[model samples]
Target: MTRRRPRPYDRELQNLRLHVGHERQGPVPVGWYFARFSRHLRRGEVVPVTYMAQEYALFRTRGGQLGMIDSQCCHMGADLGRCGRVSEERLVCGFHAWEFDRDGTCRKIPGAGRIPSRAAQRSVPVTELGGIIWFWHGSPAPEPLDELDFAEDRRRHLYLAGEVLVCHADLLPIGEHVTDASHWAYTHSPGRPMTSVQLRDEGRRFSFLIQPADADDTRIYHFRPYTLISMASPTTAVAVPQPGPRPDGKPPRMAFVAAVSPVRPGVTLATWSLVVRKFGPDWLLWPANRLWAAFLWRLVRRNHHADFDILRWMRPVAKDLWSVADGPTVRAYRRFYRRNLPPAMEEGAEERVSGMS
Candidate 1:
């Protein structure tokens, strides 16, 4: 598909999160990545981050610890992220040399004789894991990254760090794309859909059985038939909690995982990763090699990037949803979002779209 470059939205609608109520953004989760991607930040550095619907400042201390607080300083409401400097594990305000410790306690005010007990700024918890820094958005402690147990076992698979890009759009399209199994038949296949979809782990994991190779079948989506039976088991195709276990008592061929965070109105940032087998063919089937893992990663990356243009501009509207079979799968996620996460926008603050109702 030919891709179109993203055009900027209306100026007034840029910071949609700031103006709109949180409820309209859909059950926007309160998990990590609000500081967008933070593993790159080092000590004594102050950076501004927009999370969910608000902007905040992140500070790194001397010993490689991170703290999240409001971007504006408590004193005189100065933009702390602009000129703030760290002083011995503390973030000092640029305007008045006000120093805040890793806990956000305003310990020093320079010439001020008395340090007010209320001078402290409330902070969100921060944790660095697996090269990504996670920060809690709400009051509770941030949950550690839901990493796969298999990831720790290096003997099984080799992981390739992939691309990270920011998009200006909503996530509903993404939710729809994954569940739209029919698209596989038209865009990625030779007019044949997936053969089976088995739910596992209380609907958290999935096992997709695609139609095996045929002479008439053309693999447009980069989905090659499993040449190796061990690496291509139908047991663990695409899962949420983790890919399903190999029924043949083996590891996965590769995995594609991506997440999108809505930080501003008409703006979002996402992270992606691909993992494959560390070694070449193990028990054998069709004489496959270790490079199969990397090949799968490239295919996954190509397939997703093909949709980037549409994803960046697709608006989340009820009228666009199409499906009967996949409805339950997509709705389940939205239901969980509504019940657990807060809405991303207020009803009145939503962007006024004209054509696409």
Candidate 2:
């Protein structure tokens, strides 16, 4: 039998490069918006959803319906969030008493001789799923929501979640922070010696393998309905596999899952979760777990602060202006960006022209 020659790693790297640049101005991929938690807008609350900094009124009906409409009253542009009221499942603009239904149709215009047919036509696309409100701004045509798949054994874990609005910074920078492993060495040192330096460095070499949830063959289990396992990277060849079923017989529901969405161009809503097994269903366990999670949350918060400082400085420049560090995962990420971002943006032509002129 003849043995085939092993494929070269450099060849794989070349194929994976995604040339991202800032010149081709269009909306970022819509995958960036789905499944993001909007905490300010409580259940059955109406709030404004802004894209690229422009506002659109978003609301959920008492019957568990979702809706989005122009933030201004069609008659006299009044800020809806400040002066709007939900009456009988319709959003009434306070300035001129214009009423819009769940579909964004102008249901009533008080004292108008006759409501124009066009008044009832305009509506923005919206979707509600798994405790999230999603507004589709790209096109009128609807697209299927991304589905999440979990392995059978992993499905038994319960999940817990929380959302916070950072005072500064956008979603992209924060999402990128998750892939940054070097920060853990210094910022997350916490006076403890690095026990997993090699693993950390190795993990950083992996790039995001985006696929439909149905296509992903990863395990996802959660401690609660809200907590979900998103994806997991395969173990490295050199690493020893930890024992399963845990010493306690109850394994965590989800090892890790993060769903980060860009609520608007400048603002981001990140929904993250941790899965744990039901520890006897005792009410006491809830508080105990929360306190422990809070400690972990603080560590994460400090690391985010460090990353925010770095990314905030780099945001003004095109991503192409940056260089990938010498690591397998970092190189893979650079390649992915190079291939996905438009050629013009990847070349930084926009920045170059702006500087020259």
Candidate 3:
């Protein structure tokens, strides 16, 4: 029997590559992203902010209101964040002394007699809640935020466990990792695997409840959710243990809220805040919670740090080989992203298909 000569090395490799991988860029999800901590920006200070792969001029007016507008001055295209000053509740361009209102309407032109209709700058909607500032992306008007959801956080007696900032190369992996139950054991907890999970898919907000394998026998434990993983938008998530005395009578785990914004296609900035409910009498509550927050912070920080290297370098697989281990929570997260892709992405996909036809 004569053996045929082996196929050319390059051609064989190319065939294998075609069958194994073909990566394409996908649209990024956009919505309200946490921009900055409210305390970071003082009154009458204008600063440059980069988010959603674009630049913005963020400022706090003398009247204590936050304003975000297009960074480029409409008059002569000067960088507003660098050459802007806040005066009289308006943002004044330093280059030509042109003044613009918080709404981005050109109010005054020093030399020019009248402000032209096209001279106005584009304004972005910004709101501050619970000392966190959020900016709307992809639209001029912001969607309504549920104030009731954060009632406990706004309480004066609450304790802040401080903030964490992590830079990611790509955001999809981190977003999906928020609710990935199987990875909990290996990535964060090590041995305590996730035993039960409940997913709540609420269109824009996807949430899930996770219970560890080593959980105690607390009555109505399954019915009463322990932890909440909420996605405010595709880029923001709030992960916190449910508020209650622990089964062992220990203080509950501190809450963590992580918000993400894309600095560019492959770079994402994630901001995290750790919080714990205050306990004890009002006078002692502050000091006690402060100490408690410090302890809780260490616990949450460890888990967060474990994910840093993994998430930073992770790449999307061409095809996911999911298994039974990847439970309902992970499946729901994938389904949510698929069903609620950004409107721009949906439009582009349609255009591509139509052109092919």
Top-lDDT candidate index: 3
For model 2, residues 234-343, the per-residue Cα lDDT tens digits are 11011111232112222333234444444344444444443344444446576766566566555445544554445434343343343343224433433332333334
What does the lDDT read for residue 156 in candidate 1?
Answer: 57
- Return the candidate ranking by lDDT, descending: 3, 1, 2
Name model 3 segments beyond 4 Å from true.
1-26, 139-141, 152-168, 213-225, 243-254, 280-284, 347-357
Scored by CA lDDT, what does every candidate get?
A: 0.51, 0.43, 0.65
Report each candidate's C-alpha RMSD, comma-separated, in the order given.
8.7, 15.1, 12.9
When 2 and 3 are scored with lDDT, the better candidate is: 3
Q: Is candidate 1 or candidate 2 better by TM-score?
A: 1
lDDT of 1 by residue, 190-218 (tens): 44543323333222223333333244553
lDDT of 2: 0.43
In model 1, the runs with Cα more than 4 Å from the true position are: 1-27, 149-161, 185-192, 195-254, 275-300, 324-327, 342-357
Candidate 3 lDDT tens digits, 67-167: 89988888778978777999969998889988888889888898788779998888888887645788876532566654214524555435343443444
How many Å off is the CA of 15 in candidate 3? 39
TM-scores, each model vs. reference:
0.66, 0.56, 0.78
